[model samples]
Target: MIKDIDKSDVIGPKSIDSPFLGSIPVERLSGGVKTLILMNNDSEHIFNASACGDNCAKWILKIAEKKDLIIRLGYLMDFGKDEFDIEIVNIGKTVHNSLELAETVLDNHLI
Candidate 1:
């Protein structure tokens, strides 16, 4: 996914190969990649989902399936039309699809 998004191949723990930039350190990766990495590895911290673009929504859902993930989104994130179970913590409701999510978000002013 990082490869697709960043156009960089992760070569090693601290190395990555960007087609245009040549070899670079991991620190040079985009904020979205860094945020996704943190969300994937550290289950103890609450991540600011606002740092991620809509592209990261699916990954966030994937991580949630593996472990409990609590994220705060400052904007509306399109989770696609496919059915998904997301508990809106603010409204105490579980939404199944983007439409439901949108309704819930507006009803609760979550975004």
Candidate 2:
């Protein structure tokens, strides 16, 4: 139910449509800001998610090239604190670091 993904969880081996973000691990996407979550059926697990942008997603794509990308995360506030915001994070200095950074920000919300 939206929360289940964790900082330590592996998000992908990637798909032709969805891909992984290097060693940090993540699921890839296409357009507008989206909410991604990891969940289980027992109702005991949860992973916080964020509304992420295209550029941010591209940063996630970068991880494919570099696994050593360390990350720092930020948030795109939407209409104050009422509406959830888009999260921004650096996967490293390169590309896919976005995913890792995003993961870190989201992970901060849960496991």
Candidate 3:
């Protein structure tokens, strides 16, 4: 039996299978939208995800939960061919902080 999943679990059985691990292309579209492209080797059913962009993690998680989105905790290649390591929760908080700071600065200047 596996360490976490029970014997009757459907992860490795016929229901769910992962022949290719970490082989999906995640694209960060504008307006905090993201899409996961499945690999040919993948079963076309199972996938994964980590985040969308700087502050889109929370929304991503929410939408994913309802739509049964597949999350891939892997890497993403941007248009500029850059790579980054990030989390959705932290990014959301950071963006919120930045917006708050900007608002405060604008208010002070107007006063």
Tell me, by lDDT, which candidate is best. 1
Which is the winner by lDDT between candidate 1 and candidate 2?
1
The per-model lDDT (C-alpha) reads 0.86, 0.31, 0.33
- Between candidates 1 and 2, the one scoring higher on TM-score is 1
What are the per-residue Cα lDDT tens digits for candidate 2 across 1-111?
Answer: 111222133344542222233343234332121232221112243323233433343433333134322222245212221222233333222222435544554665522
lDDT of 3 by residue, 1-111 (tens): 111221122343223222333222222122233233231223456444433343444444345444544445443312121322222332232212434434543444522
Best model per TM-score = 1
Query: Would you list the rank order by lDDT, best first?
Result: 1, 3, 2
Pairs clashing within candidate 3: 48-71, 48-72, 49-71, 49-72
The TM-score obtained by model 1 is 0.91
What is the Cα-based TM-score of model 3? 0.25
- The weakest ten consecutive residues by lDDT in model 3 span 1-10
Q: Report how far residue 86 has shifted in candidate 1, in Å.
A: 0.5
Write the residue-wise lDDT of candidate 1 on 1-107 in tens digits: 57866888989988999998889999988788789899999888888888888888888888889987888888889888789999989878988999988888988
